[model samples]
Target chain A: MEDALLQAFLFAQETAEEDEGSLIDVVPGLMVWTFVTFLIVFWVLRRFAFGRIQGLIDQRRDRIREALDEADKARSEARELRDRIAQERQQAKMEREQILEDSRRQAQRQLEQGRERADADLRERLEKNREELDAENARLREQIRRDVVELTLLASEKVTGKVLDEDDQRRLIEETIEEVDVKRLASEN
Target chain B: MSPLLAAAESDFDPQHEFLLEEWIPLHLGPLDLSVNKAVVYIWLGGIATILLGIWLMRFGLSLRPDRRQTTGEAVYDLVQSQIAESSIPTKALHIWFPYVASLFLFIWVLNIIGFVPLPISNDTFDLFGVELPTLGIYAATANLSVTLALALITFFATHVEGIRYNGPTRYFKSWIPEGAPKPLLGLIVPLEVISQFMRLISLSVRLFANMLAGHMLILVMLGLIFIFSAWWLVPFSIGFGTVIYLFEVGIVVTIQAFVFALLSGIYIGGAIEPEH
Candidate 1:
């Protein structure tokens, strides 16, 4: 095999020499060498470089996808939180309105009760004043009658220049009072 | 002769510089296990890619990625969205991601390495007592063998993926469009097979020709100054070469890498779900 290779090489060298480098001749040996070298390169690159790179790229892609998913999750959570807060605020607002309404109703009821109590108290005071006024008028009228009777007695004594006994005077005054009463009744009728 | 003149004269040999050199020679049982500059540069590109992968992996894939991790993720994302996800079915992206990503990165690094100037002192090295240029590095993609090998891999992988997706018998049957008349089968089948083979050739040649042409243009432009050996041509050559170099490195490298990956994805996708 070695002898044959040597002979072939010798023959190629002779031809190469004769041809004087035509630039078209194909060298079988160079082709074989390039093939071997390239194959080795391809193998190395495939096994070590490309293999790892592909894995890494895939991993990076997955990580990015996961990150996007997490971001979506976070955004949803934030939206939920906002919704809950809004609901709570609405509840508080409604509660506040209810409390205010209740207080207003209570105040109105108390005002009405106070007004009713004041009205009752004012009516009672007015009735008591009327009774007092009637009593005072009756007392004044009785006193005036007594004074008139005394004056009539004094005038009679002056005219006669004498004084009457108690029984006689009483009878005379009674007669005069009866006559006055009759006249007053007729006039009223 | 002045060293500068001698150096310039030596530097202008694109044939010597672009051709494969056996930097290290070995044999393994009817196989010539020799290392050429293209292979060496390829090794460098591979090492650089491996180191970058290791550095990125050190970040350990985080949710909050750092700057380095972001950059790494961007590359992976580009491959995943632009190549794997766009090309294959959703279910199949997982299976095809690594292969597609590896191809893109490998080719990308390999294309970009052409811009890196290696330190080779013309003062020291000689080939058969003949003076040579200070540098002899070339992009592996510029080589026919390297591009052919990569395209071959794509071709086989596409067919295999097709078979895996559609059963062996159905896979071949899918080549024929549905609802086509029976008489057209005779013409279409051969054309389809031819086109399939043509894909492989075109894929290989496109990358090879683009890289090769860019490097050759730069080499030829730079070589003009040396070939003319005139002081006046120096600025023109250097200016033009710099502009071309920048254009190649900036635009060509990125476009080629993208196109290669895009085509591979499209091809694999078509095979998986044939138009018919």
Candidate 2:
């Protein structure tokens, strides 16, 4: 029985003698080797792969922030442009109203001057007509006096063959008209 | 001779009673890699976890998460908060969570596999020319390969986190903290460098030792049931086996998984926060 147990122990350790050898040679020290390998691999991976990925992530974050800032700037600029356009439109509208008001005032002034000139022309025509009527009335009165004097002289010539003076003609005309009216009335009675 | 050595050998090998070779070939390939049965079960458990995780993620996701998704999310958050963020930075933690969670769940499922009943017996099967041992991959934690793979992953993650936290020059300096009294650094630096390399072995061995010891104990206990001829001995041994099996289901699997995850966290934490 001791031999069998011894045999088992030998079997466990035998592969170490082979030239190509099994891992058993290092088996006793396996723990030490494993520990060392693990640490070295851990260190190498940490330095190369992990560090690079982290940098990439940080860079991506910064890019996103910059994009957001650009978007904000664009929005603000658009709003400012809209406000400026609104201000310009309002100023233009006010200027248009001022021009319209000025045009109305100019037309009103021209109309007033045209009306004043027509009124002056009407007043001058009325004064000239009044003078022409006065003149015509004096000429008709003279013609009537000349015809009455001539008629009185022709009547005198036919009756007594004599002509009257100018002053006497005037005074005789007034007296004959009054004497005629009294004689006509006495004959009718 | 020691009494213990005598008892260890004379004992009619419980493993020998069953004609393991008559039923199946022990050596599998040119390397004569003995297919550890538990190793196969470990692979099955890992595959099951991956398939289930994918199915749940694919069909169960909702804008307003359903109950399944809610449960998954809760567990995920728990792992993230308790294990991941505590060790790694919040910035880098999300990137590492998937790999960490995969390792955790994979080991967990593998460890618990022994408790789960297999539809097919592990008994040897007839092959093309000869009988072949049951081909199965046990909980990877039970085998050296799976544990080594996990350690390698941890090893890679640590370095990655270290680099992210500190550039190469600063990272190497982290092996020895800032204020070690310049003269003492020469002595301490070699020790620090040696310890740094030891982390991989430590990581693998911790899980491997716990899992290997537990499986060997269970195997011995179950193998004992087959050794005795008395009918009464069968009942007693079976009862004890059942209890041990149940404990494995409840405690061993969870504890081993936690240990692996905890160690991973520690390794990553040390790398990122060298100040600690």
Per-model TM-score (chain A alone): 0.54, 0.48
TM-score of 1: 0.80
Which parts of model 1 are misplaced by more than 4 Å?
A1-23, A127-189, B1-7, B120-133
Per-residue lDDT over B12-47 for candidate 2, one digit per residue giving the tens place of the 0 to 100 score: 342221111222234434333333343344446645
Q: Candidate 1: which pairs clash? A: A5-B30
- TM of each candidate vs. truth: 0.80, 0.50
The lDDT per prediction is 0.76, 0.57
CAPRI level of candidate 1: acceptable
Q: Which candidate number maximizes DockQ? A: 1
Model 1 DockQ vs. reference: 0.30
- Estimate the TM-score for candidate 2: 0.50
Reference interface contacts recovered per candidate: 0.53, 0.00
- lDDT minimum window of 10 residues, candidate 1 chain A: A1-10
Candidate 1, residues B135-205, lDDT tens digits: the string is: 54467887778888888988998999899988888888887778878988999999989989999988887
